[model samples]
Target: MPRFMGFVKMEEGIGAPPQALFDAMDKYIGEQSAQGHFLDGGGLFGTEDAVNFVVRKGETTRVDGPYAEAKEVVGGWALLQYDTLEEAIKGQEEFAELHATYWPECSMVATLRQVADEPPAPAEG
Candidate 1:
């Protein structure tokens, strides 16, 4: 199965009370898990508190936020496992529908990824 990362972008100033939002998210996770598609998922605080870094020349450029334009900013994400891209897309669509019910203004994006290969065997100590 391949792993996919999905981001749920929240509308500006649309955040709900933390507990309420978390409860809704938990319900969604439980539903997804019951369907065998949920691997892991969670919510995040506002982007200003998250970290973003970039490489420029030989130096690292550190930024304070996983910031983005208001319309495209991500508020939370989930990681899921699926047997095929079609399954992943289906899962993403389900998520979007659920999110729309609870968060009508939000949008979603999903990226498919394969796990990286294991590192070469370490030298004997």
Candidate 2:
């Protein structure tokens, strides 16, 4: 089975009541799980509270909040396990529909990858 990373971009100022958003997300996850396509998922805090880091010229720079954007920004995401890329895409589409109900401009993308048996190690010292 392949794993997919789903990045969900939300419309600006489409904030839902916290409880409503949580409830909808829970229902969405439950539906996906029942369909055997849900693996794990989480919602992140607003971009203003997120930390963004970058490495350049052998130096590390940390920035508060996500990079500047002209349009929508990622509000949350999920990881899905599926038998095929198509299946993962189907799941993403479903998620998009659910998000769209609250965020008309929400956008989603799914990237499929094979899960490795072990985590990769850092470069040798």
Candidate 3:
């Protein structure tokens, strides 16, 4: 099975929603995990608490945010293991559907990236 990292990107300036929204998402994710589609996941706070570090040459400069300037920030993430990309896509579609049905006022984008497997150790001669 291939593993993937799925994340939700929330539009800037949107504050956290009511606990009911979180409860809905948690229930859905919990069901998936029980079915083995979800490995682990959690939500994140708004970007006001973010810090950005830019490294130029060997020097690192840190800037504190109001990441208000960002267009979108990851609001949550999940790890999934699937037999194929199609299965992963279908899973995300279902999740998005849940959001559409339960959190219509929310604006979010969901995306998935495959997790690379670790390489085998070099042969010992």
Best by TM-score: 3
Model 1 / residue 14 / CA error / Å: 2.3
Residue pairs of candidate 1 with colliding backbone atoms: none
**Candidate 1 off by > 4 Å:** 17-25, 66-71, 107-125
TM-score pick, better of 1 and 3: 3
Off by over 4 Å in 2: 17-24, 66-70, 102-125
**Higher-ranked by TM-score: 1 or 2:** 2
**Candidate 1 lDDT by residue in tens digits, 4-70:** 7887665545656345545676787898888777887776777777777778888898788635655
**Superposed Cα deviation of residue 67, candidate 1 (Å):** 5.1
Best by lDDT: 3
Note the Cα lDDT for every prediction shown: 0.68, 0.67, 0.85
Residue 14 displacement in candidate 3 (angstroms): 2.4
lDDT tens per residue, model 2, 1-125: 66767776554455553455567878889988887778777766666677868899999998886446726666566777888878777777776666557544445443344566478998999
RMSD of each: 5.5, 4.0, 4.2
Candidate 3 lDDT by residue in tens digits, 1-125: 99999999978666567677678878888888888989988887777777889999999999887775788888889899889999999999888877777778888899999888997799999
Query: Over all chains combined, what TM-score does candidate 3 have?
Result: 0.81
Total clashes for model 1: 0
> Cα deviation in Å at residue 69, candidate 2?
5.0
Would you give me the overall lDDT of model 2? 0.67
